[model samples]
Target chain A: MKNIIQNKSKDLQNEIDNYLKCITDSSLLFFEGAREAYRGDYDDAENRYRDISELERRADEHLKAIQYKLYAYNIAPDSRADIFELLDGLDDIVDRAKKNIFQICVEKPVIPDCMKDDFIAITAASVDAVDILIQGVRSFFEDVNSLEGYIKNVYLYEKKADALEEKIKRSIFQSTVVEELARKFQLRYYVEKIAMLSDLAENLAKKMLMYKIKRII
Target chain B: MILKLFYLSSGLFMGWSLGANDAANIFGTAVGTKMVRFTTAAIISGVFILLGALLSGAGTTGTLGALGAIKALPGAFIVSLTAALTIMSMTKAGLPVSTSQAIVGSILGWNFFAGATTDYTVLYRIAGAWLFTPILAALFSVGLYFLFKAILENIKIHLFSLDWIIKLSLILAGAFGAYSLGMNNIANVVGVFMSVSPFVDIQVGDYFVLSSLQQLLFFGGASIAIGVITYSKNVMMTIGSGIYRLSPVTALIVVLSSSLVLFLFASENLQAGLIALGLPAIPLVPVSQSQGVVGAISGIGIAKGGGNINTRLLGKIVVGWLLTPLCAGILSYISLFIMQNVFLQKVFI
Candidate 1:
């Protein structure tokens, strides 16, 4: 019984372990780059963007390895396709985070005084959404019954991030903080970038739910 | 050794044709889909079939023996040659056929030529088995599929492990299927030689003995193995890339169920059990593996909700079922006539 348990959980464990590493790694690297940019350390932020690129590449490689191994090892064909698709969707989150950090570094978009806390808040909420999604993914493998709670949290933070994105956009357009429409558009683009991060997390959570249903059926 | 071999070569030829065609039934899906190489499949099947024929290809009487025995070596050779030719023709025509049916028909034709009595009771029983093989195969496959599906769904096994498990199951089932095919069908290949066997009991050790029938089966098995190694690739390639997209698991289930029916039909213990229960014993018949496989496949198709069932394929198979015995019988009769009238040989003792 113990041996069977170990074998059954082994693949799920690998999925969770690898997925969490990419999620955590991309999230941390992106945030660190954002912090350095906020502190006017463009060189450091640029370096971090390079790191995020490196991380995303590594994550993709890791995901491909897991995909091949899982397929080769013994997952049922029906389940195999779903897992590959799920991981593919999850990998999107890291890709988006890497792109967002790269956008900030290239544009060197100036952070205005009034929207500083809001930008930070937006980043935190996106991170939280992803964090919840990661947990949901973990709980799904650990105790599938308990996955709903983490999934709910993922949705909750996604909605929260969406609202924060709306507030930041409104403040940028309505307030005379920078005076140029182009500059305001730049701010909106960066704000939407952060919101899209949570969007990706929410998309991943939905895919996870899909895979769960597939498992059940 | 050489003269004896020449006499029984026809039987070995029939065995070769059987292995060439039936190799598709056991290893088609795996080889077709490129999961396993044709060479690998052939080698594995060959080894298992040889083992199966040597070990359990015993006591193949009751039905074929009752039909009529070719008591003369020349008559047995003629019958085997006729059967082998029929099978070769069918395979050449791209039809998967039952070598068992061919052998039976040939034996009956020889019975006619030799002026021996063909027992209707034995013919009726063999006919009945051929009739029910597909039905029984379908039923067994449906039952086993549901049982396996239930267990898998309940366990909700991780996907990777599930794949691993299915592949392993397929290998085991395929091996067993090949073994069972050899065990049950070896009779068709060499059963005609039983009465004509000149060899005495082969004493191996103080406790072991190889009978004449077993010795004939071993040679027949080697020819079958040779057929697998040399041929089987063309059929595999044709079927693999064809319209049939059956999963490995489905293939495994079908093979398992078909082999089970074949094994059950061949089992002396099971026949004895039936007799003990005061029921008619299952005839030790050389049942059609092709029919059994078709039946199992149909059963799975039905169980999987019936929409995917290929009506055209089923119809073709049903037609072939009717055609197989008739073609074999007529060919055997004509061949026997030529051998008797033209060659002027005594076909009976």
Candidate 2:
């Protein structure tokens, strides 16, 4: 019976890992789509953002599953609350990112000379952090040893996201025309969404670390 | 036995008012700030007040017993009932006043009516404490405001950087306020009963009891706690609406600050640490929770801009605080005079 319970929780963890992988892949596709849109490939960017939104929906379902289990078991009320809150925060990030892409498609923004590198860095960092998050939760559940290094990497990724958001904000301020400024603002908002995605990933990794500390998982 | 029952019932009523009104002081700021819903705030304050009373109510009972010559069971009952009624009536009028002042005033009235001389030194200390409460509170509020702001700004560090820190601070601060409220204010709810328990009696001469003072205090604390949980909601609502709005963080700060001051005053003996600092010995004067928090709020309002401080609300509070003792004293005097002249005389006749 104990083994059955353990296996069920492990299965849930695996589901989370799978969803996270989809998130990373969708993120990459969205970034590429964004690049294409910047280069006037509007249809492809729209498709990429649509795919990312669908991935976000899947992630949302996994989060709901985790929440439902936490509520069912009544294990640690505080921990459960934190997890649910973090999930909502994660969903918010994806929602914002998708919304920004749709707006960008509507505008057909003239890409700035400086913002291209910042936007690329934002996408790369966001994707990498999600990758790190999936690995952290997976290895932590599978074996405690796998999480030690990955958790630190998750922090590094979050910092990278923060840096990217800052760069994007600075680029937005430097844009001259109102239209360009507005487009820069949209890009900055998208970058911030991606940055918060890293924060959510970092939070999950921390939760996994705590569960291991208490030997509760 | 019937007379004792009357006082016991009154004590419970007082407790309920204390729970409803004073508990708000502990939690109002938090509720006002929208940190915790009103229902959650009420529950947290109510449960913890009871817990604190059950755990450390003895010291407060002792303070009440030592405050005056409340020896005879009958006299004790009268005093308790008088104080309780005074508190209830005052509370009903939308006044966020202290039951502490009401009790002290009623006790003095009881002494005058009985024509008994207790100790002058005790009375003097109490009166002095009462006089100094507002001044001390004002000073503390102004000083603590700047002090905390300085720490928050100058430290250049956030204490809540980690998630666990946020969770821990909330729980710790809430529990501390509840505990301190229980410790200091339990006596206000049940103190008169301590002197008039079956085991003790007022001899009109000394602070002697017929039985164990501790037992009576415990009963008073327990009964008052019950009252607060059951019927304090109306008073709580009155406070929430009447006083400045409270957010959860502000409520937490208010409760913590008031509870800390109350605990210091109620301690059995001054701590060596506090004494070494050359701070004056804190007298066991039951400070009003309303006064403590209002003072804090006024400090906050001043810091923001004194114009933001609602003069109308401030006026109401000031009127209530001034009138509580006077009204309680006069009402008790009239009630006791009637009891002694009309009712008691007829019964004896």
Candidate 3:
């Protein structure tokens, strides 16, 4: 029985590791795609978008498998629902990353040189927030006590993303270089889309904090 | 032959009730939290309970015998019947009840009816053990709680591995709890009938022997096992979710601590070992598993900073401790009178 339980746990852990890897890979892909788009490398950004889309599909498959195994193996019956919610929240991070990159690929907005650095900064901040959130989720499974520190980092990166997002929007509208209102709105839309990743991460961090409290023995 | 079986049925009925109610104390949290399936818990608890009764049930039975030896079969039957009735009535009224306390009270009533002198020393020992059972369990749980907490904090085990550990621990603890329950409370089921038991000792060649007392306990244990198989699921559910929502880890600790308390009071080998070590021997007496569980939970509450300790529930348990025996004693005396006079049966010799 012990061996059976250990094997089940190992199997579930492997699946979780795979799923988390997909999310982490998507975040990296998102950062690269956003940087490429701002650099006017439309073909490279489009390729990154395709890679992230595949990862999103794989993550969905992993999520379904994980949900099945959790019920089948009857692991942590009391916390199963919370675990499902946490996994769904994580999957959403990758999903949001995919959608944002897809939008950037299709819209192909011409980046003004003055706002390009800020766009890259916002993407880096959002990706960093997501990276820390992934670590927090891993810590939730491995060492819940260490999870609080990771969650704090996620929040910090999210705050940076928020500040950078506001700065980029203010600059796009205030600068005399981009005169068209429609072009400014397009830039603002891209900024919010990228910043939304950090928003999702922040919300997930709050939920993870509550889940951690419930997990305390 | 049939008449003897008829009289023994009351004791079997008592055993059934014990299994129905007390098995919950052992496996309730595990089943309630869905950590273990009901079928698995029942099978494990049933087998261990019978094994414990067959192997080690004599110690606590000796203590009960010393309390009041019901010399007549009819008297023993009446005592068991009245005790079982008391438990049923009290449980129906939503009052706390213990088979150990009820049986002792019924035996005292038998003594009164038979004009026999009650052994106050033995009575005091039994009563003292009853009072100490929960406190001992409480102390054990508190110590175990800290130990487990420290180990978990230091180890930082993964959630999946921890869940596996808790599930396995709950099963092991439930088995131990079932064994201890059988060892201690089998006395309450058949102890009174030991003096009048009809079974003869059997020897198979030179290797195996089964005494009449062992035969009696075997039957009593079977009845308890049957009760577990048939009626314990709902009780387990109620105990698991209704009475203080215990996490799987806390449930393991509670079962372990309570089982240790029951084993201390029931294991003759442990008692002998203590005496051999020049320490005072632990008394072999039937103690309530319900009391042990309650005490363990209270210990946990205290360990968690004393909030959520229900003093009103504690007060009600105390009232139950006092009231169960008194009610059983009165019922036993009246029932014994009716059996002797109205049924024209000899209740005493």
Candidate 4:
């Protein structure tokens, strides 16, 4: 009976590790895809978008499997709901990453050379926020005390993303880099969409803190 | 033979109530948190409790014998019956009661009625043990809580692996707690009948033998096991989830600490070892398992910075501690009087 529970727990742990890996893979893909779009490499950007979309699908499947096993095996019965919520929050990071990359591929916004670096910078910050958030989640499971540092880094990256996003929007609308007002609005929408990833990460970090507190015996 | 069985019924009833109520103190949090299944807890606790009773129940029973030594079967019956009745009534009134305390009071009543001198030294030792049980449990828990915390912080175990460890630990601790309960509290259920026990010694093999006292303990232990199997689930749930919500890890500490405390008081070998070392031996007397659990919980609460101590509940338990024995003693005295006079029974000889 003990071996059975240990084996089941090991299997569940592998599934969760795979799920988190999918999110990390998607974040890397998003970073690459946004860079491709900025560089006018539309083919590469499209391929990255397709890969992230597939990863998102796989992550969803993993989430479903994890949920089923959690209930079926009755692991951590007291913290089941909290565990599910934390995992669901992580899935959102990948979901947002997929949508961001897909939007970049479809809209094909023309970027000025001057503001291109700023846009990539925002993407990098958002990706950093998400990467740190994943690390925070892992720390939550392994070492709760170390999780606080990861959470703090996530907040820092999110703040950096927010600032870079503001800088880019201010440059786009205030400077005469783009002549069309509608194009500026489109660029700003994309900026906000990318920045939303960091915002999602920040929210999840707050929740992870609460979960950590509860998990502490 | 029928009359002898009839006289044993009250002791069986006391054992049943002990099983129903005290099993929760061992397995409540584990089952309540769903870390362990109720059936699993019941089986492990029942088996271990019976084994402990059969093997080590003589120590505390000896102490009770020293206290009063009821010589007649009918007298033992009345004492056990009054103790059981007092426990049931106190439980129904939702007061925290201890079978150990009740049985002691009942024995004292018997001592008074039979004109047998109460052994004041033995009585003081029993009272001292009751006071020490919870405090010792609390001290053990506080130390264990910090130790576990330090180990967890230093180790790099995965959350799932940690969960598995805690689940397994709870089971092991519950078993130890059940064993200690049987060794310590079985006396409360059947100790009064030791002088009047009907079983005779039996040799099963050239090397294996069972004494009459062992057989008596086995019967009492079986009654407790039946109570655990049949009626302890609701009480387990109430203790597990209702009183104070303990995390699985904290629950493990609580069980281990309380079990150690009970084992300390009940183990004759340990007492002998201490005596050999020229140290004072802990009295082998039954103590409240519920109080031990409560103390362990409080120790953890204090370890966590002492925010929610629930002093009101502690006050009520203290009140119950005082009132239960008094009620049992009074009831035992009255019941013995009627048994001797109206029923024409020889309560004492």
Best by TM-score: 3
**Candidates 1 onward: DockQ, in order:** 0.21, 0.05, 0.61, 0.58
Classified by CAPRI criteria, candidate 2 counts as: incorrect
Per-candidate Cα lDDT values, in order, are: 0.77, 0.62, 0.91, 0.90
User: Which residue runs of candidate 3 sit more than 4 Å off their true CA positions?
Assistant: A1-6
Q: Candidate 3 residues A1-217, lDDT tens each?
A: 4432454878899999999999999999999988998898989999999999999999999999999999899898878899989999999899899899888889899889988888899999999999999999999999887899999999999999999998988898888878999999998999998999999999999999999888665
Residue-level lDDT tens digits of model 1 in B17-80: 7887787788887677655657668888899888777777764543566687778777788888
Ten-residue segment with the worst summed lDDT in candidate 4 chain B? B308-317
Q: Cα miss at A97, model 4 (Å)?
A: 1.5
Interface RMS deviation of candidate 4: 1.8
Please provide TM-scores, in order, for all candidate models, with all chains considered together.
0.81, 0.61, 0.97, 0.96
* Residue runs of model 1 more than 4 Å from their true location after superposition: A1-16, A28-54, A60-92, A110-179, A191-217, B1-4, B31-40, B92-94, B205-207, B233-243, B277-280, B343-349
Inter-residue clash pairs, candidate 3: none
For residues B1-349, write the lDDT of model 2, one tens digit per residue: 6755665666666776676667666655444333334565556666677666666666656666676656655555556677778777876786766788788777777777776665678767766665555545555666656665554334322211222232334446656776777767888767776655554444545774434445454555555555556655555555556545553334445555666677666665554456778876666657676767766676566765575565666677678767877777777666667867776621111
Instruction: Compose the digit string of candidate 2's lDDT tens values, residues A136-210.
Output: 655543444456799889889888988878867775776563255556566666667657667777776676667
DockQ of 3: 0.61
lDDT for position A114 in model 1: 81
Model 1, A149-208: lDDT tens digits are: 888999999999999999999999998887898999999999898899899889878888
Query: Which candidate's lDDT is highest?
Result: 3
Compared with the true structure, what per-residue lDDT tens digits does model 3 show for residues B19-78?
A: 998999899988998888899899988999999998999999999999998888999999
Per-chain TM-score, chain A, candidate 1 = 0.90
